[model samples]
Target chain A: MTRLLTLACAVFTMTLVGCSESGSGDDTLTVGFSQVGAESGWRTAETESIRSEAEARGIELKFSDAQDKQENQIKALNTFIAQGVDAIILAPKVETGWEPVLKKAKKRGIPVILVDRGVEVEDESLYVTLIASDFIHEGEQAAKWLAEKTGGKANIAELQGTPAASAAIERKQGFEQEIAKHPGMKIIKSQTGDFTRSKGKEVMEAMLKGEGGDEINAVYAHNDDMALGAIQAIEEAGKKPGEDIIIVSIDGVRGAFEAMVAGKLNCTIECNPLLGPMAFDAVEKALAGEEQPKRIVVETTIYDQSIAADVIDSRKY
Target chain B: MPEALKKLLWPLAALGVLLLFNTAMNPAFFSITISDGRLTGSLVDVLDRATPVILLALGMTLVIATAGVDLSVGAVMAMAGSLAAMLLVDMQAHLSAVIVLTLGVCALAGLWNGVLVSIVGIQPIVATLILMVAGRGIAQLMTDGQIIPIDSSPGFAFLGGGTFLGLPFTITLAVSAVVLTIVVIRFTALGLFIESVGGNETASRYAGLSVRGVRLSVYTFTGLCAGLAGLIYASDITAADANYAGLYLELDAILAVVLGGTSLMGGRFYLAGSVVGALIIQTLNTTILMTEINGASVPVEYNLVIKALVVFVVCLLQSETVKQMIMRRRAVHD
Candidate 1:
């Protein structure tokens, strides 16, 4: 009898707590965020930014990690929909296969915000806005800097990312188109580095021994890790990287800053990953029935050796 | 020639054909120069980059010779690299301490898989599959899902990037490890024991051989080789990327073992053959990167397709039945 009475009191106390939570009305917003897995330092930093931002805003956030799988992301979205969340933020792993689940969210009248990467849906109404850095612009920026630094004359060795990836395709296209503007700038040796440091080093080593090895004057890598790897290869080949061969790459990660400070890397185009404030602001506007634009492009910054030492300390990633 | 010597002929011929083709296409492919007191050439790069795969194949050869496979070698690499980076970068441990602790943990990980396979009676594939998935997760946890850079350590970088007598230090490390392994397995009766267990496990057990002990030893040894490889890889890049450090490299190691004429059914391993097989793969990669047509590197899309065709042709050439069919057809035409 005593056990039953204690259980009754516990249940009565939980019910009272639940009643007070709903009694507080809808001022407290609950949002769900589905993140692609922590595949790189940039990705981890993005996730950290979002989580801390949610905490600061006093919003109840339900976060899910997809581990780089589309199916897992879809499952997270369905769960959020079942719970009747006020909003959903998805960092899609790929560009396709999100139409059906996103349509389900639309039926439930919940707004969706796409972050970092977007999905291909036939219905634009499925998502309120997409906030991401422009990859092609990043490539164009690297080319422009290299052209300016080299005075429009250089034989470049290009260290590309993985084959057929969207980033690789767009970056190659952008760099080629921009470099075509200056006839003196030409890519003498180009190969895929697969966006990893080791492969980058190996490819650079091979290309350094190939024809035009001596004539190469500049290096353009799709990411900072590859540029760093190329730096090692260039150093081993008895060439000064930043001085003898101007080097520029995308992804303004912290390691790039260190390399710049050491005078081993020339410049890095910033692919800023801090999107927390913008995502939350968009969420708030959507909640208030305010119309948002179809897309939001985050501004980027280019970092060179001149400011690397000053900016390295404040870099979050 | 003896049977052992004859078995090496196929892989050697394949490697020779590739080198000849590369030389014909690019006259500078064979040229070597001394820069910064280190050898610089396509050939040296091939040997240097083949170090990790060569080491993994050596371990994989022993495991396959025992009629079992360890799918977790790649994951073990990730774990070992992550541990080393954490110890050196985060905990600020000494280089020697970092090496010993990282390899020790990897061996323990292999021992765990052995216990599950030998004692708990789980299939080797399923048992190792558990660690293959969870090991990467454990690695990410150790690094807090960040790529840890181990910079400012010339002593550590020497393992992968330093030069010894104008050749990469990695080549020397891989060669010495392969030689030591060969001596240990061949000079001792361990070779016979492994063959007996894999040839017929119940028969070996009835013949008073400890099957479980042999399996345990092979797995532990493989774990140690993978740890060494992980160190070389992280040293080469000077950073530990948990997600892509040894991604899908287990398949490369297995392919190298099979290409060396070591059957997956497990018996009669060839250490030299595995080394040559790894060279073949690396040479293929170097060739692809060095080749150019119309003033541009071969479209990156054709790379894997060409690799697949070449590997398929080599496998077909290695088969005895196909050889007989070709010989018979030639005889008929004559």
Candidate 2:
């Protein structure tokens, strides 16, 4: 048994060494990517897009699934730094716990591109560039659409994302800022659904109970998951969701469009997660020392029930 | 009175002290009101959130009573909720009432845990751990890794949203479960048998008590509790995201059990104390967030750190060395 265990350990070590040797070539560009994990459809799509883009570019992508852990992502970044990768791409799980890692990467002269999510670091030079959707803009768009649909007089309940996530914080800020402009529109009750469908449903149920049936006119979810939950709560209360309570959310996922077409979802603000092509472009520019904006804001569009059917069929992710 | 009542004094005293501290700090802490005939505000929210942890702790109490632990209750909740969601996919409109669907699915998941721990003879921690990792994967797979929003389910909504006597429906369910559990343990000989088995499995078998049966029943009970929590969770959200339902709830439940003075080594149990313990934890979390003391600098994740500290302090107090030291100090002071 002792001999067998020794042999197994030896074999595993050799397999890893052999795998690394096979991929070590001069032409291959080593790109390290720290992902948030396969937590949602958006994340999976982002992963696939990154993989496909890396393959097409002939870049050796060192991918790490952080599993929604900041420490894991930090470890992965350090590992990439030690391995001396040409560039690094990170989709942070949360905003703040990233300053030290980014500073380390900057000191090492490895270009770090922020993808999908932004970090809360004071020094702008620590990161090469941020490639992400304008999260606050997405929230603003969702609120704007809801305001127009309801004629600016509506009692709204908000289902926010995970409390610490940068996306949730910015999205809430943007929505609140826009809604505050309209005196008639008020957020009657707001809660952190933690970007989970069940929490969204639970919070919405509580909101429904608190606000009374048919008292709420709209729900502005930070993401499609919460909007879907609000729809369930509304329907369970023996009311039509889109008619009785307009549902507007971010994350233009396939489900969001389907619901829009079915008239259950009122509108969705697109926050594109497919940042592979753009991220690659930023990486190439940073490596070549070309001038690039510190923050790259990806443009987004609002989708309503009218065009939802037409676009739902062709939606890639 | 009874020895059971005597056993509860410490926990009750701890609760009283904490409540006093809270009231002193915030004058409005004890103020609870009903608006539009419904309980509104932070107190109601605390009760609503405590429901899931209360159920998990109740089941854990029994598992610990058997000298074992189940770290997979949260995963079981995800799996049961996912299974129910999968079954209701096409039959969303035609499915039975929310209570039936939720309870039935949870029962099935509970049975799965019981079989693995009892029949397979796998260690309780290892068995539940497998479900913890795989159950979330299964839940994600059920929804095709997407968040499924369920609309038009009044029966489901009522499970989470409806109120009774100005209290949320979930609190009512939790209270009833506690009562039912108390009856089973106190009124029947099963509770005594379980304690005897937990105290010494070898001796329990030698005495002709069905040790395996007791073990199975404890895990099954935990599974049911987790299932009920899942239903309440799902009903509240009105949609199921297999990834996030009951996430990290096992930790909270464990913390509650520990806070109530129940030993992880397992021997006896305290169901009511555990419920209060769960409420205490929720209140602490709510208070921390409401104060808004720069969560970014001192992130909300520090709640886990605080929980670990509380557990450490309690476990230290439980240690013979600490107890002896305290007794020595007391004797000298007297």
| RMSD to the hidden true structure, all candidates | 4.1, 7.4
C-alpha TM-score for every candidate: 0.94, 0.69
Model 2, span B185-248: residue lDDT tens: 9789988888887888899899999888898888878888998888777667656668788889
The runs of at least 3 residues in candidate 2 whose Cα sits more than 4 Å from the true structure, single-residue gaps closed, are A1-32, A54-66, A69-86, A94-110, A119-126, A211-215, B1-55, B84-138, B141-144, B148-184, B198-213, B227-239, B251-334
TM-score, cand. 2 vs. native: 0.69
Residue A75 of model 2, lDDT score: 97
**DockQ of all candidates, in order?**
0.64, 0.18
Please give fnat for model 1: 0.75
| Residue range with the least summed lDDT across 10 consecutive positions in model 1 chain A | A16-25
Report lDDT (Cα) of residue B202, candidate 1: 95
Best by DockQ: 1
**Model 1 C-alpha lDDT per residue in residues B1-334, reported as the tens digit of each score:** 9776788899899999999999788667899888778877888889999999999999888888888888888888889889999889888899999999999998888888888888898988898889889988888888876778988677788888888988999999999999999899889999888888778899999999999999998888888888888999988888888877888888889989888878888878888889998999999999998887876777888989988988998888889899999999999999
lDDT of 2: 0.77
Per-residue lDDT, model 2, residue A218, is 88
iRMS (Å) per candidate: 1.3, 7.1
